[model samples]
Target: MAELVRVAALTGYFPTMQGLGADPRPMLRECGLSPELLANPEQLISARATMRLLERSAEVTGCTTLGLRMSEERALANLGVASLLIAHQPTLRLALQALTEFRNRINSTLALQIETFGEEIVLREHFALSSPEPHRQSSDLALGVLARFCAAVLGDGWTPLSVCFAHERPSPSEMAVYRRLFRCTIEFDSEFNGLVIAEADLDRSAARADSALASHARELISSVMSPAMRTASQEVEQMIMLLLPSGRATIQYCAESMGSTVRTLQRMLDADGTSFSDLLNRARMQLSSQYLANPRTRITDVAGMLGYGSIGAYTRWHSQMFGISPRQWRASAARRQPQSSAF
Candidate 1:
């Protein structure tokens, strides 16, 4: 089963209906999706489904620049938490870090890796678990998003130093749009997928990077990242930190919700030198300490939230794991906080 990618949720950024042509329903239908689903702001579709639709639209419309068209519709808020980090960071380095770290919160299958050279920054795309065809389409979509992001960030003055693709040579018209959008040299059939931008240009400072704007942008992006990466393992762990109140936490339900088969998912996790069990235990331990320290949630409710069938089960597990009872742990945590003045 394919996981819902929540592309429609992203319409907060790219909600243009024009140039989409009459009866866009056929395009959604071709992609194995419903046209009605596109109207729902809260709806999500599978990455594979969206890619298939994009490819079909490209072929049907004879427009290889369809990716670019979609990206051009993006509103800055749609980039989510990424927008906040990008807006406030003192330098491009921090901005890229926030992006790389939180990318799964925006799009799970798409990974952005940034390498800084003498005067240029290389942004590479690593697509997750995709077939060759969708992989290519993913790269195209990634490039389009990056181009649009940079354009928005830099405003009218911004242009990529150069653009490169891994696909076959683009046609004259496609190349023209690429050039027009990027306003710089566009190269196709390159070794990797990324944009080359001068370091100096990235630091030039945008007109919209004020502190107030950065703060509001941060809040908006954080909300977007939370939902978008809800199905993402790392982000899910982050969510579990807040969701978990006590005891043992499991990854089974999380994996199922993300639409991943257990064994195959475990294999991919192993490739990352980790396991689902490890992540679950780590999350449990981290959240247990935090919840125990907080006075707001009751002990029983905390245990229940952690999926414990009974208080006894949670207490036993806590004692075995940390050699301390839950009450003792909470007492210790309370002692660490500053005391309130009764006078």
Candidate 2:
């Protein structure tokens, strides 16, 4: 099935492209989209097409940070109904929780996972589209918008410890744009794409938080969203993506995390015409493409990241699914890139 996200994903697309001296209309048509669709933020559109458009736009305009440029002007209001719920939360932690809870309504393919360790917190954002195509632009835009949201709630004094990107670093000019916006350490070609902040940052009180308004917004959202906004299979797929790197994506583990027994979860997936193994394989397929594409990642490490117990097992399975050794796939991916391109 084709994955869909809200039209709001392209909120600043038009002006951003025009600012870079390109006509975005042609790009929209190329991606099977229309300007009319951008006019309605709530409309559902093809997530893959949206990703292609952002990537192609960046290529044509020679603006490596196209997504971040579009994200510069995004305010909480751009989130529509979600803005109310998030903005009124008393703490950054709760606001982010609200954002994650209502994320499917905003962008169905986007997922956020929060991890805490000692005195730090990592806000990991994943854009899990069905295809293994590039998502660099979307990743940048999502992180940029997330930074804006955090700063909004925490006041201007907010600054994360660092921002990480799975993709390699860009040119000096592009790096300047990133440094200016994030105002912190920027790590590229990292294991993940996310923000690292002090754990205390999440507890900072929101100056504008209103319990009354938050309550009203919560009630309104509950009334508007159906209980079946996401399918059982889709939810499990999300869990698999987040847990895959940690080597704990087993059905029993996921079932326990979701507050259900393994048998009950299996029955739900049966109704959806899929199984836990099917979803796990799909997630591995998509993620392996990403991991292998990064030359800095070791094949053995990639195996561990995919939850394989040994290199031989990862190699055999990858060869069966992709018809090539992981090393050969990485070489081919590297060859496909322009020598002049930094990433």
Candidate 3:
């Protein structure tokens, strides 16, 4: 089975803003979640609960636009913190580097990575396990928010070079909408999901940048780090590493092994800012290196032990995570080995 993405603790960004003229309480209650739960930023809800909330919120608000709105809300709510890192860094590259580092503090599930390819800056989304159902919606929502957030930070005219998605082939309708929203090319069903921006855009100064503002933003993000650290979760991570070789691990199985209810296990993981799905992928990524190091292990067998349905799936995931095929990885590993000297 494909690994699940975790989104519990990260959902705390869905604040219950009383004055926003929309009562998020009824929506939360319907999903068996509470607005107060946001207070415990470490607390996590189940993927089921998160999906229900997303669907119900759309139903309640009568807005097909909730995904983008939620992304923007998250960006706006956290701008104070983001500005601190983005404002003072010596260059846009460094600012993005800091943003990538501190992204977990906001939502650990929103896996953010910055890559530079020639003149382009790519902000990739490694989706978390607990993201909303209909994975395409969640992926698109993430990309939309990121594009808007960068524009907000760098100035209104900022645009991306291209936006890419791993699933859902881009349609003309989506292309038109995406182009209108981001003013960039939208490529779907790509090898990865991320946005590509021109390198020059990073050098453009934000409308608001000053030492005092930068210092204040830094202080806020810094203060949150301690509390975030205190609540970090490692049990699921440990369990995931253990189960990767066996490849039969399920959420229920993991909970049983941990001696807890599934809900309890999920909650603990959420508090730690991760989920079973995220942990599994991470374990596979880590173990691929070890397994690939052994020439005796066939790529097919490695895929089976990792619980992949087929070697193709495993190879695709491996390439996405490590940027190389298993065959290539194994070949590279062999080349790096020191030869024995028979004196």
Name the candidate that leads on TM-score: 2
lDDT on C-alpha atoms for all candidate structures: 0.60, 0.86, 0.60
lDDT: which is higher, 1 or 2? 2
User: Once all C-alphas are superposed, what RMSD does model 1 give against the true structure?
Assistant: 19.4
User: Alpha carbon lDDT of residue 98, candidate 3?
Assistant: 62
Query: Candidate 3: where are CA atoms >4 Å away?
Result: 1-30, 35-48, 55-66, 72-75, 79-83, 87-90, 128-134, 169-177, 220-343
Tens-digit per-residue lDDT, 1-343, candidate 3: 1232234323323552332356877877887777676565345445456655765665565544445445544544443345466756645565666655555444444555565789887776643442223433455567776787677667677788887765444435434455566787777545466888887877776655566766777787776666543232444544454455456567888788767888998888786667777777766765566455556568898897677889999999989977999999888766765542000
Alpha carbon lDDT of residue 286, candidate 1? 46
- Tell me each candidate's TM-score: 0.60, 0.91, 0.54
- Rank order (by TM-score, best first): 2, 1, 3
Task: Quote the positional error of residue 246 for candidate 3 in Å.
Answer: 25
| CA lDDT, candidate 1, residue 10 | 34
